[model samples]
Target: MSYAEINGLSLYFEGHGSGPGEPLVLLHGGFGAGETFAPVLPALAEQRRVVLVDLQGHGRTADIDRPLRPELMADDIAGLIKHLGLGRADVMGYSLGADVALRTAIQHPELVHRLVVVSTPARRDGWFPEVVAAMDRMSAEAAEPMKQAPVHELYAQLAPRPQDWPVLVGKIAELKKQDYDWTSEVATLTAPTMLVFADADAVRPAHAVEFYALLGGGEHDAGWDGSDRPAARLAILPGATHYDILHSPLLARMVVPFLDAPA
Candidate 1:
């Protein structure tokens, strides 16, 4: 367990394994901590150092007075990389964390060598109507019944102030209600990026293709010799949904090769 003071937040991170190339920095989804990746962490760390981070208000990192915004959280990640003296690193994130990862690559491309965005959309509208409606329904009241859920249980065990669980829940609810669109930013991103999604995801499938297109992928087929492929890549994993994709072993299977590819 290590904590770095970045952007006025005491960001918590754990390091595992060690190999070559830039370290892999992982950001977990909302209501989760670095432990969220426990199921696949070993596979991801086998070939490189993996840095698992608890984003603002999650895990052991206490919340501050600021709202849970991706842009601000991105700055914290970039600051953390610099603070750790990692000059540049590969970043992978899921769901809410994916939003921060995308923004980090966009806003701090020089600090990111490779980016993996999992189970998130480029725009708020890219999500299915049902998902958006669910976000609208998120509230402290709605979170009451969820105290028995694993996410809340983990919070109770690891959070600095377990009583703040409802506060975190309300903050997330407010964060989800905010709007954002990063299509233009994504289209201009310079980092090598891979967009990962579950076949059954909260994001619409068409939007995934559009997200890939913004990254200059899926516009054409690779030649027989494989020279026409774009720098960006896309994968929709089988038998997975947004809820369970992070735990699927296939997530590591798909991510490893992409991160291992030569830059």
Candidate 2:
């Protein structure tokens, strides 16, 4: 366990494994913590130093008076890499974390060596209409019903003040409503990238292919030897959904190789 004082927040993170290869930083989704990757951490850490980050307002990290923007969180990640003396790292994030990871690579390309984005779209409108509708309804009023979520239990156990759960919910709701389109940044992204998502994720399947095309992927068939293939990889896990993809072993299987591959 460690705390990196970056910007105005004391970001929390934990180191796993001490094996060879570049360190891989793992970021969890909204309302989730480093523990969100708990099941696969051991496997991912087997051959790479995995740093699990708890984004601001999640887990042990306390919230400040700021909007929960991916760009801001990405900055915190960039600072964290510097503070930890890692120089550069391979970053992988799920859902909300995926948005932050994308921003990290875009905002500070020098700080990220490679990226694995899981279950998130390049544009805000990439989500299905139903998902958008659900997000639209996210509010403090839903806090009581949300207690059944695992995130609530974890927050209750680790948050400095459990009663402030509604605050986190409100911030996330506001963030969900905020419009953002990173198509330009993503189209020009310089980092080697891999996109992972469930076949039945909240994002539109066609948009996934489009995102890959922007990254110079899914355009040409790799040679029999894979010598002509682009560096980017796109995997849509079968029989998986956005909700359970994080805990899926398949996620670790796909992520480990991409982060370990030489660019």
Candidate 3:
């Protein structure tokens, strides 16, 4: 357990395992803390140092006055990397955290060695219409039901201001209502990336393919010799859904090999 004062935020993170290669930074989903990755942490940390971060307003990190935005959070992540003196690290994020990780790679390409984006689309419209509608219904009132959820239970235990859950819910609701499109930015990302999604996710499968295409993947077949392969990779886990994919052991199985691949 550790805290780094970066960008006026008390960024909380914990380092696990110690092995060779660049450290891997794991960012959790919205309303979730670093502990969200507990299921896969052991497998991931086995081969390299894994740093689990509690992004702003989640877990041990208290909420700030600013609205929750991926671009700003990305900057905080970049600053955290610099503060830790890791120089460059592999970053992986799920859901809300994936947005921040994607932005971090886009905004601070030099600081990210590689990136893994799980269960997030490059644009707001990529989500299913039903999912978008659900997001539109998010509000402080939704916090009550979520209190019974595991995420909320975890937050209640770890959040510095547990009573502020309603506020966090409202902020995230507002953040989701905002429209964004990162197609152009994603096309220019310099870091090698891997996009992972469940077969049944909030994001449309077509959009997942499109997202991979923007990263210079899935446009062509790797030749017999494999020299024609794109730097980016995509994986759709079978028998998984967005809600449970993060906890699936298959996530580590797919991620570890890609992170270990030659640069």
Off by over 4 Å in 3: none
Please tell me which model should have the higher lDDT, number 1 or number 2: 1
Screening candidate 3 with a backbone cut-off below 3 angstroms (N, C-alpha, C), the clashing residue pairs are: none
Give per-residue CA lDDT, model 1, range 218-257, as digits (tens).
8998899989999998999989999999878789998999
What tens-digit string does per-residue lDDT give for candidate 3 at 47-74? Answer: 8999999998999999899999999999
CA error at residue 23 for candidate 3, angstroms? 0.6
Model 2 worst lDDT run, 10 consecutive residues? 254-263
Ordered list by lDDT, greatest first: 3, 1, 2
Where model 2 places Cα greater than 4 Å from the true spot, the runs are none
TM-score of each candidate structure, all chains considered together: 0.98, 0.97, 0.98
Per-residue CA lDDT of model 2 for 28-106, tens digit only, reads 9999989889888888899989899989999988888898999999999999999989999999999999999999999
